[model samples]
Target: MTDNPLSQAEYDAVTDAAAHWCMRLHANDCTVEERLAFEQWHDAHPLHAFEYEYEYEAMLEIWDVAGDLPRPETVAPMVRAKPATPWRTFGIAAAVCAMALPLAAYSGWNLGWLPDSYQHFEANDNVRQVTLSDGSQVELNLGSELTFSNYKDQRRITLKKGEAFFSVSHDTRHPFIVKAAEGRIRVTGTKFNVWMYEDQVRVNLIEGSVLVSSNDAVAGDGLRLEPAMQASYRRGDFTPRISQTYDNDNSLAWRSGKLVLDDLALTDALPLINRYLSKPVMVADNSTGSIRIGGIYNIKELNNLVASLPKVLPVYLTRNKDGNPVLNSIPQQAPKS
Candidate 1:
């Protein structure tokens, strides 16, 4: 392996070429002519071999994490055919790369030629904090899933589910966009919160400004929100209802491990509360879902809250056959029997 470092452009070209060769050589439909061509390319220069080895190693790592790999016998011939070299000792790298090619494409590797890279993040049981390449910050609430891609001219985030808070770094050249469900929140730099439910998306702006628009919305045809403002729209709705003023403290209570349910329906509130629980709370029927409640509760004391639900609301908590907590409307007493 050559120890010399190539320039950025040169390194990118080599890696791009190596990635293409890696894919072509391992393809099920790869031809004899293509295999010969790959060998020639690999031996053309030491840098080519070095980069190919690196790319092969990366693909193997991805497959290792995924716990799926091609059989060693299927890939042994490719390595044994090559002349003995420091970079050609691995017998399974090419097979692993070929097996994971589809995943690589889905993950935005695109044969290593795409300028933008993609990342996925999830907060399964606790909040997660992430810093982007451009210095922007994100905080994902429990059970939230986020996908990110940074292009030359844009920083995009897809909120696949649940909620997240963002503190974006100022960058006029590259707009920051957050996509949740069918809606998009666009800004140059700002602090905001986004919550994505099954049928709705809510945006709360804490600093700077943002444009809340739908996927099919026309230019300048979206709602603009300033500090202390909020907006929400259901899936497929292009127009969002904007609230000029909102309760900042209540809106952001989750960051402090608290939930502030101010007149929110039980159905609407359970989703937020269940994010902190191992077993989610479910409504027994639609009648129980319609009961509105208000209170501030610590997320850590979820069991206690479940026990006290009957005291504050006209609903009682029971356990299902599987031991999952279920909320049901209280049975009214008979006037005469």
Candidate 2:
């Protein structure tokens, strides 16, 4: 064992780093460069390797308690240490004591453990409001789904679909994170709205600040976003863009039962509009999808917007057999006889 005496803060940082390394090692596709980086990190400090080994042993102990499961064949064999009293062996006594009876069963040294229970919020036709365990409030927009899980050191939220506005409470010790689509948003205290439309992810900062990054935490320096700014990333794109002057209020208009589109393409705007109703508005083809539309219309006046489409552009609107709106381009009219 290493002989370094660590301060509480230093210990937490080392363990967090160890957790990240352990997670990387478990990945089946961990590459040569990653292994080399791990080696370099381990060699940088004696305590680094020691923390990793301790974490690995704790994981193995969990597997042993789970059943006599075999260890991952890739890792080098560790000399078995005699087990001590239950939690003391892993140095997780403080964490175990912090958990309630039910939560203690689910809490583990692994990085991915969720507490005993999480709050699941899903919205259909109407928007929903949720207050988390840490006093953070979320305005879940229509057709959205998310799960909120709290741990001793972090508040984690996974947005499965659609959009939500987050009002995060201040907790410097515990960061607030939202995982959506292909990236994540990390914050200490902030107000922001995140929208996931298919493979695209957009985060608009209303106040305070946040760090936005791709799912790969080690890949690149994450983007820092401040008030009145927006960051957008799409799948397969090399990099995301941060807009200094995006009209964020337009996106949040849904909270007031209004639909606001500001020169947005028909293809992009349709999905957001569709979220307000059960029956959707579909574009007939790619040609009609390129038309730019800008307006502020009440969601309750969807029929009026559909009726007025032909007046604004060369498009024909019709309903499918299921009573869903289908938009198509208007064919040329013949000369009058």
Best by TM-score: 1
Error of model 1, residue 224, in angstroms: 1.0
Model 2 per-residue lDDT tens digits across residues 135-183: 9999987778987767566788888888899999999998998887768
Model 1 TM-score (2 dp) = 0.64
Q: Return the TM-score for each candidate structure.
A: 0.64, 0.61
Stretches of candidate 2 off by over 4 Å are 1-112, 217-221, 246-249, 277-280, 300-312, 318-325, 332-337
List candidate 1 stretches off by more than 4 Å.
1-22, 25-117, 217-221, 247-249, 277-279, 301-304, 318-325, 334-337
The RMSD (Cα, Å) of candidate 2 is: 15.6
How does residue 15 of candidate 2 score in lDDT? 76
